[model samples]
Target: MEVTHAVEFLLLVLLEKLSWSDTKVVLPDANVTCIIPEDCILPCSFKPTSTVVIHWYKQQIPVHSYYYNKDQFGLQNKHFSGRTCLFNSHIPHGNASLLLRRVKVQDRGRYKCYTSTRKHNQEMFVNLEVKGQCAAMVLAPVYLGLATFTASADCFYLFAPAQLWVVERAPIQTVTITMTDEWVTCSSQNVYPVPQISWATNPPSSQHAIENSTIRTTDHKGLFTVESMVRIVGNLTSYTYLCSFKSADKTQVWTASWKNQEDLTYEEGHPVLIPCNAPQMLRNFSLTWTFTSSSEPTLILRYDNRTRHTVNQWEGQAELDQDLVLLGDGSLLLKKPNSQDHSGTYTCTFTAVNTKRIFQTNVNITVAATSVDEQSMQRSWWSTAASAVFVLFTVIVALLQCVKQNAKENRTASHRHNGTGVIEGGLLLYMDLNPSAVRVRPHGAGAHEQESSLVTGPDHCDRTLEPSPEAEQEEEPAEPAEEANEEQRDRFECNEPV
Candidate 1:
């Protein structure tokens, strides 16, 4: 062997010149940030000698210690009291940096640094990050992520592309609150999360808020249905609502409250109840009664648990209280109250199973202002008895038309005071020939001997025919109509028959 290969190459060169003092595994340093209150500088260095010793731990607490010649906090950490320090002449140029002031936010973590000098003891670590300060603001609408922000006022919108973002803000978004109730419609279904509805008023109208018409589909199948409503119109002021239906990560919650606070007059046509209360001996409840006057919200009435049935959409105006409605008194009845269609805003709701209830009212009918002056004195005594029965029917039709025109001028002055040619059964002999006679025949043969031979010379036709004292004073006021026309001209012996 060549001297055994030169003694195995000098024993592999004496084990590569034997000098082992480094197990080798380093990796720490990298993180070190600071901003909470400000200051932080945890770097360090060593390897200079003159007996320079340094220490700075943060796990076993004591942070910052320099040997004998200076800076040595008494086991420091009264939360880094008076905030740590160093750079003391840069620790004689070996620079065992620390500084730390103000920082707090638990000052972050991992920081070791232990350096010593009597020959070898350097440690390092580093990782003390404390961040979250951001305030020099300039983001009006700047989100490098989510999106969709159609705001109206107070804002906190967006989240999509890293999510997306854009924001703008002012304030008020319809806050006029005297809230007599304008919203209450919770819902839920196939629930895998998604729920949130709230409205409060127990004495809190501060900042105003309560106007949601939400309708996540009256929600069903999996469960949910809360309803609340109110409207007393005009001189409004009746509040005390409180509704909450949570579980959108809220873990769960349910609440309901109500109030009506009086102002329900009546008189106009009388018949109103508008009161409600339910939840005492409940029996599978479900009731509703909405009327919201002007803006249309009608659901007049509905009941659904008396074995299921009852709906009164205003036919008969509306009613409820079927024997005290399950003893919880859901009173409502507006029979005739018509103040131009029953004043307005009724709202009554009472559901069961995980319950909910709502009720509100404001009626004021008035109009029977008593007898109003006795109905205007009975309408002026019926217009003076209809003007005295129309003046006695116009004086009995002018005394029966002046006794039928003075009995037709006394039968034409006794047929001209005795002018002849008359026959009762002789067909028709009405003659005074020249006195405008009018005779007609057809009474049977010889018509009374042809009317007695044409009224037979009539003794020159009866010389007893005397009249003329101005026609007997115009037939003396129609003396019995001239004795019945002189007994009809002596039985038509001849006389007047024009």
Candidate 2:
């Protein structure tokens, strides 16, 4: 037993030496992007060696492990069940990357990949960041100037903590020319750090030449909305106007011009192309398209020197002519125009990369209903005509039924009159003197039982009339005068002879 214990101790020491010998520590930091419920790979590799053992850990928790020529999942964390995997075939090549499936929010953390072999050991570190799902940006148009310029844009982010900076944007900016004064008003909303607004006139005017008014309001979100107005005191012939919104640092400025405005029209269902030609002199300039109608204006698209971004609602609907955009033809192609909503004014803005000068052009779009809508309208008219004819036929049939029922009632009344005897001049003149008893029948008595008699003697025929069950069930009560008249007629007939 002593010898056996001695041999076992020697074998353990040998195993320890084999585990620690030639251990190479390789600590490299890696960055990985992981979206929720998607798979991500944490990369870690080392020099190939024999009989490899790999382990992946999140902080101190065991995520996954590979040992004894197979994957050892029994020691994996419960949160990673059925979601952790490693490339077993690559193990021989010293590639021990951990593949995490269905990534959760909790999966964001520092990860360590430790690999060991009979002669070598190495480890690598990785940082995982979980982000939300990605989506495309949508753009609308914002309208500016008298010629109906509109501009709009849609923006989306691939990760959280996004930021938006509008150098100068206004939803309700307008210029009006009146008999007395020329006025220009500009308004912007949802801005941060309190932007500044100013006005400049062409041919250079003094500060006293224009009257200015400004208002600013802030919301609970700590963003600002501003409105600025400028009026030329007297009737001015023709002067150019510019409105500018400058950043607090004065490094970035947005300008709106009143001189460069144009009008355009297009039919529905057809594509529209608004031309924005740029001179060869302009370089490193950005182009933006906006739409403005009777409703609010919106940003449609923005093309910086490199890429084109489409704003909300206009994604996939608006696109720049890629081949011609760089050539200074910043024309936009609008697909399948809708008359009710798309008919509005569009604006194209060009800003130089280094200069504060801005150029703008306006296009008015008019979309009418297509031939399909007209066909549907025609079908509606035919359906209305058919319904009218059916109603007229139903009314005519109802009238014919009423006329037939009235004619039958008139015939019945005439027959009843013919069956009754009339007393002349309100005098009961006995035509028959037979001393027979007269029987008076009720109103609903059968016609075959009807009898007429006359009795001239002093003894009169006596009888009482009782309403039948059917007559008692009637909702309306009979008049007393009619019953009395009936009784008098009975008495007069009874006094005469039958």
The regions of model 2 sitting more than 4 angstroms off are 1-240, 243-267, 275-280, 290-299, 304-316, 322-327, 339-347, 357-367, 371-383, 386-406, 409-498
Name model 1 segments beyond 4 Å from true: 1-184, 187-193, 196-244, 248-252, 256-266, 269-342, 347-357, 360-384, 387-391, 398-400, 418-498
- Specify the highest-TM-score model's number: 2
- The C-alpha local distance difference test score for the whole of candidate 1 amounts to 0.59
Local distance difference test scores for all models: 0.59, 0.61
Give the TM-scores of the predictions, in the order they appear. Answer: 0.27, 0.32
Top-lDDT structure, candidate number: 2
lDDT of 2 by residue, 383-433 (tens): 999999999999999999999999999998666545353344433232322
For 390-462, candidate 1 gives per-residue lDDT tens digits of 9999999999999999999999978764744444564545454454323333244521211222324434554
